[model samples]
Target: RNDHMLSDWFRKNQEVRIYLGYAPEPNWWSVADLVHVFTGKIDGISPSFRNSMTCKIIGRDYSAPLIDTSFTVAYAARTSSQIAKMLAGKYGLKLNITDTSEIIERDMYQNRKEWEVLQALADLEGFICHVDKDKTFHFGPRQESDEEVEAELYYRSRLKSNCQVDFEDTAIDVYNQITVRHYRKKQVIEGSAKNDALIEQIGQVKERVIYNSKAKTNAQAKEMAQKLLPEFSRYVVTGKAMNMAGNPNLFCEKKVAVKGCGRFDGNYYVERFEHTLNSSGFITNLDLTNLRPDTAQQYRQDLYTKDSAILGSGNKLGSGTI
Candidate 1:
C-alpha cells in the first residue's frame, strides 16, 4: 500500500542513525549542540495517516549481542570486573564497569546468555548492569552519592508554571529488610540490612534474601547488604516523569532528584529513559527508582494543642500528616 517509494525509505536491515539536539534557546549555540544518540536498523514502517503522509518507522539498536548470544562451557575470571571486560572485548562493545574486584569462590556461567550472566555477576557483587545509547555497555555499583547526580528535578503542585513530573508513585517496592549469605570455604557468613525509613513509612516488615554473594567478611556482608538495600525498598518510587523542561541530559545508572513533592521527594536512579523529539515537541521520558526514600519526611499535629489532634489513623481530627 506504499506509494511514492515510501517503503523504500526504510529497507530491511538498513542501518538507521539518529541525531538529536535541543533547539537553541533564543539564539544560543554551543559546540556540543547535536549528539549522535542512536545507531540501529530499521525494523518496520507503517502507513502515514496524515495529509503529509508521515511514515511510522521503528528500529532497535544492536544491543542484543549480550542478551541473545549464548555460549556453552565455563570460563573463569579472577575478578568480576575482568569477566565484564572479557565479555565487552568479545562482543566488541564499549564498557564502563566499576568496583567488581571481589573474589568469588566458585562462579561461572554454564550455557547462559551473556546478559543474564552479567546480571548474575552484578547481583553477586551488588552492582548494576545494562546497555545504553550508542550501544555503550555499563556495569557498576548503584549510584548513591549526591555528588554523582547529573540532574536535579523539581515539581510543586502549587507552582503550575514549573512542571516536571506527570506521574509519581510515592510508594511501590515494599521490601524493607534484606538478608545476604556468603559461603567462603568452610566458614558460612551471613549479614542483614534494613530500610529503616521505609519501615517507618509503611509500618510493616518486607524481607528479601540473597545467597552466594561476594561478601568475604561479616562486615563486608553487612556492607554489601546495605549497598543492595535501595535496589528493593527505594528503587521504584516514581514510575515515569515527562520532562517539562525538555532536558536530554538523562542517562541510565545515573541519579536524578525530584523535590517539593512531599513524602515523595528524593533522589532517584534512572533505570531506563528515552528522548522523543519531532516536529510537534520534545519529551524525555524517565523510568526512575527512588534512592533515598528515607528523605521523605512527615509532619504531625500537636497533641497538646487544640488546633490539631495527635498522631492517629485517618478519618480522625487527631491524626498526623503523611
Candidate 2:
C-alpha cells in the first residue's frame, strides 16, 4: 500500500526524479509518530516503540530529546509543512485537515529547545508602528500612542522595564518602525522646500572680487599690494603721471606733488624735465643740477643708463625717483 501511494505521488517522470532525490528512509517511523512526539505524545507510543525512537528523550517526567539527531526527520517534515501552509495561504489554496494534523505532529516531535526559541520570537511584538499603515501591525497600547507628545518617552520606559528584552534590540526595533512610517513622507515634503530654497538663494548671490587680508610677511604684503595697486591706481600719483604722459614721452607734462617725500619740507619743488616712462607707470628724475659738476654728470649718466635698461625690458616703472 505504501509503495502504491508513493507510485501515485510520482506518476510524472519529473515527479519520479524529485522523489528519487528525496527518498524517505525505510527505517523511519510514520509522520504520525513524528507529529505525536512533536506535540508531547511520547507516552502515546508503546514502551518498545519509544525506546527504538532515534531521538534520546530526556528531562523529568517529560521525555524531551537529549540527542538532536533524533529530531532531524521531524524538523524537516514540520518545516516543509509550514512552507506548504504559507504557500496555500498566499495563493488561496484549500488545505486538508489531515495535512494540517501531520504538520502539527511533526512540530511536536521537534527539538524542545529550538521550538521554545521559535515560539518566543513568534510571540514577540515591537512597540513602534510602521508609518505605512498596510505594513504596520498594532498590538494593545504597549506604552503610548503615536500622536502623543511623550510617546517616545513612554515607549522607552516600557522597553527598559522589560527584563527579557535587550535595550539595543528594543531601540533598533522602535527606530526601524518609526523611520519606515515617517522618513519618506518627511523627505518628500519638508526636505523638498528647504532644498529648493537653499539652491535658489545660492544662485542669487553675486560672484564679485574676493580678498584675503591676513597677509603678514614682506613677500605676502608685496603680493597683496600688487593686487590692490590696480584698483586704487586712479587716486594715486602714479596713475596721474601715466594719464599725462601718453606714448614714448619720458616726462610728466604737468607738475604733481609727491607726498611724504621729506622729513622737513611739505612743499613741492620745480625741476627740469627728466623721467622714464614704462607700462608699470613712471620713474621720476633725481635732482643733480645743484651738485658739484663732476659728481652731477656721473649721477645723471648712471640714472639714464638704469632707466634705459628698465624701459628696454618692457617693464613698468612705478611713480618713484631713484
Name the top lDDT candidate. 1
Write down the RMSD of candidate 2 (Cα, Å).
44.9
Q: Poorest 10 consecutive residues of model 2 by lDDT?
A: 171-180
Q: What 10-residue stretch in candidate 1 is worst by lDDT?
A: 295-304
Model 1 per-residue lDDT at 199 = 85
Off by over 4 Å in 1: 1-6, 23-32, 44-52, 74-79, 95-108, 141-147, 156-160, 164-172, 185-187, 194-205, 210-214, 223-236, 292-322
| Per-residue alpha-carbon lDDT of candidate 1 for residues 1-322, written as tens digits (9 for 90 to 100) | 3557576667766777766666476388653676666676666787675667666677666655666777465655456787777776676677788855455443456577776667677766656565655667777754556237777677764574344564444444357997787666557888889978888878998786675356778887788678877766653444456655555566544577777777777776554566766557766766555543221110011111222111212122111110
Best candidate, TM-score-wise? Answer: 1
Q: Report model 2's TM-score to 2 decimal places.
A: 0.12
